[model samples]
Target: MNAEREIRGSYWLETAPGGAPAPPPAGDVSVDVAVVGGGIAGLSTAWELARRGREVAVLEADRIAAGVTGHTTAKLTVLHTLVYDHLRRTRGREGARLYADSQSAALRRAAEVVADLGIDCDWEEAVAHTYAEAPEHVEALRAEAEAAREAGLPAEFVTGTELPYPVAGAVRVTGQAQFHPVKYLRALTDDLKRHGGTVYEGTRVTGLTEGEPCVLETDTGVSVQAREVVVATHYPIFDRALLFTRLSPRRELVVAGPIDADRAPRDMYITTEQNTRSVRSAPHADGTRLLVVTGEHFTPGAPGAADVEERFARLTAWAQSRFPGLTPTHRWATQDNDSTDSVPLVGRLHPGSRHTYVATGFGGWGLSGGIMAGRLIADLVEGREPEWAGLYDPRRLASVVREGGTFLKNQAHVAKHFVGDRLPSVTSPAPEDLAPGDGAVLRVDGHQCAVHRDDSGQLHAVSARCTHLGCLVAFNRAERAWECPCHGSRFDPDGRILQGPAVRPLEPREITSH
Candidate 1:
């Protein structure tokens, strides 16, 4: 059970090329641009820069497309859940129109790239829906449809939907597309290489410094000096910019399976209720129609989160309750940072540092957001001012002025956890007391340490303090990893860094046998 618990697959990865030869890691190759991630943003940046005849290199901590892009439902639509109405209320009509234009442009850009490169990704165009499961949300859906149409989107309201269960009403946006995300991203990578770009896998960047050529220090002790840098690794890894305070980390679960052709929804859909129902479909490598469902976000290590195993169980139950015949073939979870305001941060890292740029805080709209960020980052590097740059500038404080209360509350929560987690272990379970395949935070040698007992009954221990910001790391029983409560950095039980904000691994501790 433990072996199968966290071994969930993605439909994109299973259908796309599994094993391919990776480019060799070079010692030190300076380029005109060095993109720090290989997902949509990084690859898109490289692709765009290469088109403009600029020398670019992409440094990936993991394999290309293995980050959030691989885990997405792969919808290429601007039809976000209840966003048009909310934006209209907060950002005004013009701001909302700019957002709609950028998102629509992103959708167009993706379609253009697919046609230009002749990529073999399985693409399909379908209408998108934002439906209400509860009665109270019907009016909100209608408002959303009206606002979306006002903002120049092809949106309308309808009482009937293609979902298995009945919905109160839905806002429909036509001409949206969906495809295999990994396959499309893989083509982008191939196009990058063909346009004189270089890529390095397994390269983890640790620190960044301002210089004539900004220096990015990697975990392998290599220095990447670039005229301009784009920190596109999902969450901006830099802490000095204090971007973490403005961004809140969220985790969402996804479960997909082969369902009958008749059972599949004719269009991609989402719900307006608090715990949204994000649904889409794709064909697996064997031509099996896979239905993907994602929603119910929570902070990774927050007390409110379900026990790691329970999260997956709930996801399975959510699917079985809706589509009873689904035989699940893929399951996984993704972490994204939500910005203070609705808009993502996508300009320079800080006011003082013009060379260092970051694109984060997508708030779960990464498929469209990442592509838009890539283009924006490219424009910034070339000194061409994109129209939407002012809205997404990292230093812009309109969001802070409007949403200060929520930001302060979120920071206060962080401050509480930082102090609360270090005080003492309320539940101290000894190493010998833990069963095989279990873990806990306990007082080890008077120190609060994360201890995991393997199947062999051997204890593995590491400092519970998160390397990113000192928040206590909680044991994620589902993935058998330690996850930071505040910033969403993750580490293996053996103390190796699994994800970041934290490039450094957790400090190893000596565990005396009991």
Candidate 2:
């Protein structure tokens, strides 16, 4: 079978000790709270609601964490790439402080959740590091540290003697944390089941009907009736009229491999480079593990590997140059929604959609934001006002718009794709042009089409144009599927829709060889 055809595969949570894939929702059911998308966010929210004595049910298109959660680097930290100063300047000092406070509280709350549940997920309290190898960016690091201090974060600046290399400074966040995301989630999911929460995998939510009692419909001919709904799908499962245009999608890469424990920094670290490098180590069954990674602000359908194979190769070479005899073992990549503003959007879907709530735009730090979103969303579900509600409201002006970049940058992307498709093809690709495990866009009879060659050398072809807006879709090596660089509509290699904004699959383009 073609790899792209087989959606079933391994997820970290599904591989955990004594872990079982969440069963699909069978037939119809009614529950007080119907949670859509069984990732960390959904599971976390369901568990929280269940513990509070609510009848909760979760529905997922695949196993838990099989989506973005399965592909995360699992770095649990408050330092999310030079965000403090940026937030301070844009959203104000109070906004920055609140953002920092929310993340810190989430970190502490995660520790408490792990301990209270006694989940053996390799949980540990590790220091977090934000460094700059470029001397020019050292002041940015210093300013971030100052902002962190102002935000009430326990952060300090370090330089020279502190780093394995470089002349600039670094910010060390003490008492930050790290863990095996799937393992920790496994424990929490089990508790959710025990608390009368229902979890269903392989259940895809197709559309939502808004009313006093909202209805969530699944493609499997099952419907969930609930007073409240939580869409924890990495991207909002449905479109928000205006918010959709505000947040842009960013793709990232993460590679895990062997490292010399004696030489690697004891803490996890990230830098201030444009396509930044994040260094982190976790205790695996073998020894200390290293995640050499890159990728930020990538257009979804753009040409590239999600893991930034080139960047990872460079970072690994640098690592081995400094600390020899280490190699990468496991590698993967994922994309997350980056909102116009740095903060996530967590609240009612829109002003009038009172019964439905959504948690999205974690950027890349979905762990902390996921926890915080679960808390805030659950509060809204229970008819209670949450302290962090205003900070994460989706209705707020986008950071870019507020800062005067949204109009130009967004128009640039739209116009570039809209007109760029008119340009000539780089090359006219034949069906035989693609080797096994390869895919490309080809001009077939004056029309562009997407073609994929499976490992078995079977060629599958579909319309290259995205149904949503006619933008060309690109092959995503990380997800092993076709994605739209414009609006992030994703389809399986065979052209079946996996995500939306594009409601139809690309029609198969018949191939005729010369």
**Best model number under lDDT:** 1
Q: Candidate 2, TM-score vs. the true structure?
A: 0.90
List residue ranges in candidate 1 displaced over 4 A: 1-7, 18-24, 272-274, 285-287
Candidate 2 displacement at residue 160 in angstroms: 4.8
Return the clash pairs for model 1, or none: none
lDDT of 1 by residue, 424-513 (tens): 766787788978877777787789888888878888988988888888888877667888888889888998877778888999887864
Report the C-alpha lDDT of model 2 over 1-514, residue by residue, as the tens digit: 6432342233343356745666666677888898887777888888889999999998888677677777776778898878899889988998888899888878887999998999887787888888877888888999999999999998888884344667477887888887888888778888998999988887788788987678888878888888889888877758754566666777665555556565556667787575767776666545555544444436678655333445445655655665567555555557788777778888888877878888888988999888887887888888887666788887765555675575467657866887997687888868787877777888878889898888787888899888777888888654568888877878988898876556567888887532
Candidate 2, residue 180: CA error in Å? 0.3
| TM-score of each predicted structure versus truth | 0.96, 0.90
Error of 2 at 241 (Å): 3.1
Clashes in predicted model 1: 0
